[model samples]
Target: MNVAKALLSIMTLTSLTACTALPAGPSRSTGPLVIQEQGSFAAGGKVVSTPGTYDNNNPAAQGQTFHGDHLYAFYQIPQNPKPLPIVMLHGAYQSARSWETTSDGREGFQTLFLRRGFPVYLVDQPRRGRAGNSTVAATIEPTPFDQLFFDQFRIGKWPDYFDNVQFDRKPETLDQFFRSVTPNTGPYDADVISDAMAALFDKTGPGILFSHSQAGGPGWLTAIKSENVKGIVALEPGSGFIFPEGELPREMPSAAGTLTPEAVPLADFERLTRVPIVIYYGDNFPVEPTTERGQDNWRVRLAMARLWVDAINKHGGDAQLVHLPEIGIRGNTHFLMSDLNNVQIANLVSEFLEEKDLD
Candidate 1:
């Protein structure tokens, strides 16, 4: 985090407060102006390449260590932007825009939460969006544009709509969805992302982390590590746990190049229980769909959420898995934040946070 000296010294930082972005008129509301700032931090650092210098007579490759991955976020405080803040994390292949703007021209959670008088910090996870890249350019590979997400995420069929598709966007909106997709670089390090998140959380005050899908994994880990994280609202976390698949029980790699594998009890994460935890799933999930992959994905995710809720509750953590269909808000997809009924869900989140005393 001290690297602020390294980066800020190199360029001017961009900090956007609520008043600065307002129209030439009154405050958006009677509340404080929303304060927002965006910059990248080296949560954890690593030398990605050997340092070298380019000179008139000779050119050498500058040794570079990836300072963990970059963290790009826009934070808002009311009075304008304040805390008990909600940190929003996007899922795989998506950036923080997951909470900023929707493809249907709808406002993202950032706007909704602001209206509710809570500050918000939105994250672009490593290798995505404002969170920029870390690996050598040649090592980067883009996530394939495929039906995998559409079907698995329950957005719709590849070229057709699945039964009761809840995505609710016009056909033209597909362009926006596609445009939001970016090629990703890997050996994705969940631990580094978690540390960056923790660093950000420590720098800010304790509050909440509202994470979506893949980001849910690290969100759990970050909350586990940081006392600053008071609560976590995980939206359909993958496999219902922190740490990535293929890495097994899950190993967290630090910027210093240390790999810490999962060795703690699920009870350890009950730190979440000290506060409150909620796992929210969208509609059309429990009922089987046409694609075998989608069907299996749904079943697995549902089971995962269930398992987590059970485990967390057993550990004295107040974690609940909510199915939207069961609550009268149906036809939602994995991307519930952008659904036509998004406001309904955001309201549910706001009310839950208020009830839990997170607000």
Candidate 2:
């Protein structure tokens, strides 16, 4: 009986060792993962000779012009143009090119939209992208308020500071730098962009508006002000109403030390409901509570949209909401527009445009 027991124990140990061994598979390179990396293409569908450098001589680049006071933008007019154009707006601290690249070589929003036969225009908003502080030196130095926030939050350093922050020659905290930079004239900036688009439309034609994150607020404002915008696809728009009499929840902490009564009033969004609007929310995206009260900010955002939608529908306007699943991202956060799964987002927008006959 003892001999039989010993044999069984040895068999069990062998099985455990077998399970611990790594599964056999194809060998992987030690370097970074390279997915679908491809060469850049010009607006005319011709492959540019230089990979990274913008070719000013290209007709596609020459066709568009930038306003003297406004920032320059990159555009790709399709070789085979579709009915309407599409203007893409990047989020905070990102360039017009932010939607186009991934670490694994996946095609960006520009490539996807171009392939769909639509002319794509990417803009770098004021105080951001190439138009904003482009130097590495501009990011490191923080302002007094930034330091104060850091001290309050016990944050030692900013994440991705090396890549995103612009340090000045003298000492300044992040808050000071942010305050020093001119606010882009709020909704007026959006009006100016819309005017620029109107000129583009006069030359090219009317188009669809696509905005991500914080830019969504301005894009919505722009659409409200413009007559040419056919439709809008807003991805994760920030807080909408900022007016003193607006319908913000009483629970939300007001910006700075001001009460809700003291805050600046945002324009009435319900009145501007001529075009169809689609609001997209990512289920897996994590949003930080903007206030110290730990309110569910994203929920508030959706609620605000719902309020606007209800108001719009009452007045006979078309508005829709889309919520994406959480499966695509491994550890994704609020910046869902820049994730690898953004291709799915592109596909969704394409489908919406086609269905609405706006493409």
* The best candidate in terms of lDDT: 1
Number of clashes recorded per candidate = 31, 16
Instruction: Report the C-alpha lDDT of model 2 over 285-358, residue by residue, as the tens digit.
Output: 22444443112445456555555566556556788876554334232234444444666667788789988899
Model 2, position 149, has a per-residue lDDT of 31
The best candidate by TM-score is 1
lDDT of 1 by residue, 226-336 (tens): 899888888877633632223223332222122233334544565666868888888765544333555456655665567657766766778887888788877777888
lDDT of each model, Cα atoms only?
A: 0.69, 0.52
TM-scores, all models, native as reference: 0.78, 0.57
Error of 2 at 74 (Å): 1.5
